[model samples]
Target chain A: MASDDTPAIRLAGLRKRYGTGDAAVDALKGVDMTVHAGEVVGLIGPSGSGKTTLLKCLGAVIEPTGGRMELAGEAIYDAERGGWQVGDLRALRRDRIGFVFQAPYLIPFLDVTDNVALLPMLAGVANGAARKRALALLTALDVAHRAGAQVSQLSGGEQQRVAIARALANRAPVILADEPTAPLDSERALTVVRILNEMAVQYRTAIIVVTHDEKIIPTFRRIYHIRDGVTHEEAGEGRPV
Target chain B: MAGVYRGMVDDGQVLIDNSGADLWVVQQGTLGPYAEPSSIRDDVWRGIAGIHGVAETGNAAYLTMQIKQGGHEARVMVVGIEVDRPGRPGAPPYLTFGRPILQGHYEAIADEKTGLKLGERVRIRRHEYVVVGLTRRMVSSSGDPMIFVPLKDAQEIQFLKDNDALINERARTAANPAFNRPGVPGLLEAAQASATQARNVNAVLVRLAPDVDPDTVAGEIRRWKRLTAYTRAQMEDILVAKLIATSAKQIGMFLVILSVVTAAIVAFIIYTMTLAKVREIAVLKLIGAKNRTIAAMILQQALGLGLIGFLVGRVAAGLWGPAFPKYVLLVPGDALRGFAIVMAICALASLVAIRAALRIDPAEAIGG
Candidate 1:
């Protein structure tokens, strides 16, 4: 469960470095950001600006050099705790955080419903209940009619919608979207952003969208512009979809 | 190839089982009658029968040669058995059609594999014999079908020379000073007759009385009669362990090599299939799929492919087995063993792909 009183995602002094000594390179110098529950914020950056690194760090896919991260009201990573406070990062990611990639990246072997249901199944939910949850999300995303279809049979926009449903299937408090609408046209990209907003408000989740696509930039209530290894917050137009 | 070798081994066992003998008395100091040649005087059976523990004795001759039938030639093993009694040793255990040899000389009982029909005439050397009966599973150690003929005919066919060679031999004998001496009367003719006649058989099959130990009788024959006697167990060893040992070893090596090649092919296929799904695997990991889960997916795929392959191979072998020149015996035990081996190979082969999939970075799905 998420609430506006406690932010779903919070980071302070997050840092990441690659290699050592003479070949050492700092990917994320220091980052500070927060997004309350039921909000979708945009992250825009050029190449080599550390957006993907930050996303990886938040997704618990990579270890941070130094950071304090609290998700779903639990401090998962703190430098003073000598790294991660969570014992199992895989379970932590599975239960609390969801990710939507640049491409749909659905498991092609599974049909559309199963692709969404697999997350809950991996978390030990019963198969019937997991499929019921997946079907509910697919209905919310307006792709319920294709629940029995394979991933390859779906159109591009339909596949992306299914990916969104999959990310929201576990009822995770935090959803991280990395260029999720990059492959879509203007109308589809805006549609993807509108769906993200509706899903965030409906599920009470904090969403962060990192994209180079300018088509959906104005839809965010706020934006974070990252340069080199640092992030700067700015006020967005917050235009209506 | 291993199947054929197994069939050959089984063929040898069938012949031994059909003989229904407790002991095989071969020539002294020789491994014979099936894997090697042996020749003892035709009267050796009479001496063997007189032994205390011996219940009965029968003489048998075995020779392999091409027989012509209906303008076609097929190599077969000619087996000579005594036709004087119904239940003699070295007789075909059972007849599938017609009757056993009645008159003895020109009547032959042929294995159905020889393609000889009842009453068909086949030429064995200088004699054309009528096929009087047909038997099944009667084959030599080398997988050639067996044609049962009378002892006299088999011996003559095995030892008798052609007309020109016989005449040359008689003339040569008449010109010899040793046989044609002035004081000699019928000596040259006796010598010629002895030279031309075949008075030897391959071996003597001995049947022992009930509750009598074959080893004891065999030991007595070897000691007093000065003949090499093989008990049923020893004969089986001679057939399975010695007769076809080299061929079995060669076939075993071929099977090992084929298994390795099949493993390599399966490994390559699984690896290629894994590489094709790199993105999907990465996404699975990115979404918190456990290593065991992904590994199981790959393993299941490999095992499925192996199952399909095994079924297809079994069907193909069943379809083509009968067309081979030799017997291709497919045992249920062998099929079960083959299925287990295929699944084991497939499981082991998928390790490479499983390792590759495990090493894939979940970040690859998100991209830089």
Candidate 2:
């Protein structure tokens, strides 16, 4: 288990460039950031400010042109981990990281319970056991009554919560939420932020919430605003609505 | 035994049939639906009853003709049976709707495939017979409706012509220079009338005793050398394997084409549906859903769609098959085989969509 003092994610001197020569365009110049356990941090940046690019690198979705990435005290990508000899990068992504998108992209055919249970089931857990864990999480989130309901039947906020439950289903140490509150009202956005904080504290998980929403901006005590692929850290307002 | 029996009867040694069995004795060289055509004494059942185990027998008839319906003329075989008398071998095994002919002159029984309603009338060989009864799955060698009529009526249709043609024929014969000279023109008409009445039958039906072996009786009939006989089992085999064999193959070919078309349609539908969810799939990948899991989901959906489609197609085939002029027999075993085939096609169809989804990059979801 990763403790609160241990950093769940670390990026050092990260750089990413698309194409080469005349068509070359650098997406990430150099990024340095550390998100420790039990901390829900905001990533605030303008559109195309390399916020997505940096997030991709930090999430290990895209390989960096140059840098080191460490998650949960293990160095996943470095000067040495980068050689062309590795057999699989997909397996690495599946086992280590979790993601929550801007929209609650629940599978429509599945019910609310199975939508959250799907991640654990994908990890080879038995269906009954995965569903059991899903129900437990749903109960904790106070949405257990809707477990049998189809995902299409759930409201937007409820659907986002189900998506969040899905992100945490595998019990990964790090969660990257991409504009998770983008479609919500101010109260719902703050509710999601508060939920993320409680989940991080309870699960000892590190969370990075990438957003441009101002309503929940002050809820995060720590913030990383990126520009031109460079990130600068600042203490958030820490104000309660 | 039929030849020997016939010999004894010709020699005035025995009475009608004392043997009891259910059988179809056809023409020499013509097995049931085969090459030869057989004619028997119309009242042979009376003799057949005197044998050993005949409960009862009836004259069942079959011949090919062209029927005009819905403005399209199609060549079809007309199977005539006596439905007025129940418990006869020639009667339909079951009735679907309406009453049996039961001694009605113009009433007839028609298979559902002939597009005849229970109360409809059909013109067979210039005689309008009312369809008072209906049967199911009763077809001839060439997939035609077996129309059950009274033995007398079927005989009329088989041999008798219209009043004008009969009169013309009698006049032509009466005008024959060798027979008439000049004294009697209508005199020959009376003689031709008697000749027309002697039209007997094309086959003999033998119903055997329950315990008696039909194989032995068939062998006996063949020994008579002047006739042919078909046991029940042999008749069914001839009907399904030889008579309808080519037709079965034709429908089988249609089945193959339909299977392929179904597979292609399912693949296209599933592939298109999957493409619509590319972003969701990529996000799923980035969020750590396994490739196999996603593949299984797509596969299951394809299979589910095929299952529903198969149900609809089968029900549609059944509901509308009777409207066709030719017989369309949808057997239960055929339905089961079709279901298995549909599932296999569905499984194969999903592979294309699965491969497409597997190739989606998780990075795409993150960057966009």
Candidate 3:
């Protein structure tokens, strides 16, 4: 069980290698990071800097060659085991982590409410209860009016908001956003960042936003810059949105 | 004669020809080849007449022969009946033109399909007969037109050898030296006279008393007369089951091939539909949807398509069944069985698409 003082996510000496022998290429080398509850952090790097690889390792989509990772208060990966400690990585991902991608890839056949409620349903929640939870999150995200609309009928901004609502539907402790605001205008980009901040504080969730977008970089109070498979932490200007 | 024996009238009962007889008796194991002539000694008619339930009995001869008409040979079934009355047991059920064959020889009644007009002459077995009447739908089991001739003429056509063959047979017998001895003068003539006589009939047709059951009469004849008698139901079985067994097997093979083709087409369609949604599948997996959930969706879609196709096919078959040249029976039980097979095929066909959907990697949804 997680305690109040436990960090939402922690990583130390996380390392990943692509292959073995002479052809092997190390993607991550001795990276360390931590994000507490109720905080949102930024990860920015150039191409081939291992940002995506590290995010994948943190999300448990890929295994780290050597590392220690803690989610909430539970130990998920250990360097000695050389793998994840969770019995089922898929269930671990569904119950403990959320993801928002560059494009809002909502299921085309499902309506907005069902698109958001699907996560809870997969986690063994009843259909009606899942929909209620989805409606509540949609109301908080200000997209409740389009709850019954198809994903294709919504505007670009509306679709991204629905994706955010889906990410928060399961009340997961951590969310990894991969260039989520990349396709938005500056105003919409800042609006997405502000919503992320509000959601992080209200739900006590830890969020890591990975991006190369210069327009929204200043909104983060702390940013980690990666160069050559290594991360260096620095303080952002923390400009208000 | 075969067609008349098996035809269903408007009231759904088997049509009885002018033959007021209810049942037919033939030699054992000879019912299958009804058109081929078989001799029963001509005296069996007396034994059949003595049966307890028999009201009347008549002897008939059947032969399939080629008749010369307008420089062409037409295959026909020549039937022989005792024309003593207007509506005898072996006469055509109804006539459309001219009149029945009142004389016992040299007169004929032909089916309309034979193209024989009233008062026209046709040659059969070195004898010219005048067609006196025309009938409709009077055909043999193989759809050959029937030509009704008198009892004695039909017997000669069925049993008498050609002139040359008969002369050769008599010469061979005389050369044997067993019947040509000097003391046996009448023995040789007696043998020749017996050879020239035509005294056999193919079957005996019997009419039962009003209150007697045909099965009971058939049993009695079989027990006492040492011959085979067939009731109406038994005759129907012989015509439908035995005669058409090969055709039924051919149709069964065609149905199997059609089902296989339908399954392959369904599988291809479902596989293509799944491929179109590959991106959506990745997204679904990344959002933590289970494999079974995706599989069930594809299965349901396949079954829905099959249901629509089956309903349309059934309606089309029903609309066109009556117009077929032969009888096409579309029973409810066959339709239900077809429905079950369609659903099973759809379920099996969706497996290919389900397997493809399950193999989609969730990492593809989150590009690096």
For candidate 3 chain A, which ten residues in a row score worst on lDDT?
A: A81-90
- For TM-score, the strongest prediction is 1
Q: Tell me the native contact fraction for each prediction.
A: 0.69, 0.57, 0.45
- Candidates arranged by TM-score, highest first: 1, 2, 3
Residue-wise lDDT of candidate 3 within A1-241, one digit each (tens)?
7778789988888899999999999999988888999889999999999998988888787889987898996889997875778898878878888888888888887899999999999999999999999999999999999999999999888899999988888899999999999999999999899999999999999999999999999999999999888999999878889
Ten-residue stretch with the least lDDT total in model 1 chain B? B1-10
lDDT for model 1, please.
0.91
- Across residues B100-147, which tens digit of lDDT does each residue of candidate 1 receive? 899879999999999999999898888899999999999998889999
**C-alpha DockQ of every model:** 0.67, 0.48, 0.40
The chain A TM-scores for the candidates, taken one by one, are: 0.97, 0.94, 0.98
lDDT of every predicted structure (CA atoms): 0.91, 0.74, 0.82
For model 1, report the TM-score of its A chain. 0.97
Candidate 1 residues lying further than 4 Å off, grouped into runs, are A1-3, A185-191, A235-241, B1-5, B68-72
Residue A179 error, candidate 2, Å: 1.7
User: Cα lDDT for residue B266, model 3?
Assistant: 96
Worst 10 residues of 3 chain B by lDDT: B2-11
**TM-score of each candidate structure, all chains considered together:** 0.92, 0.77, 0.68
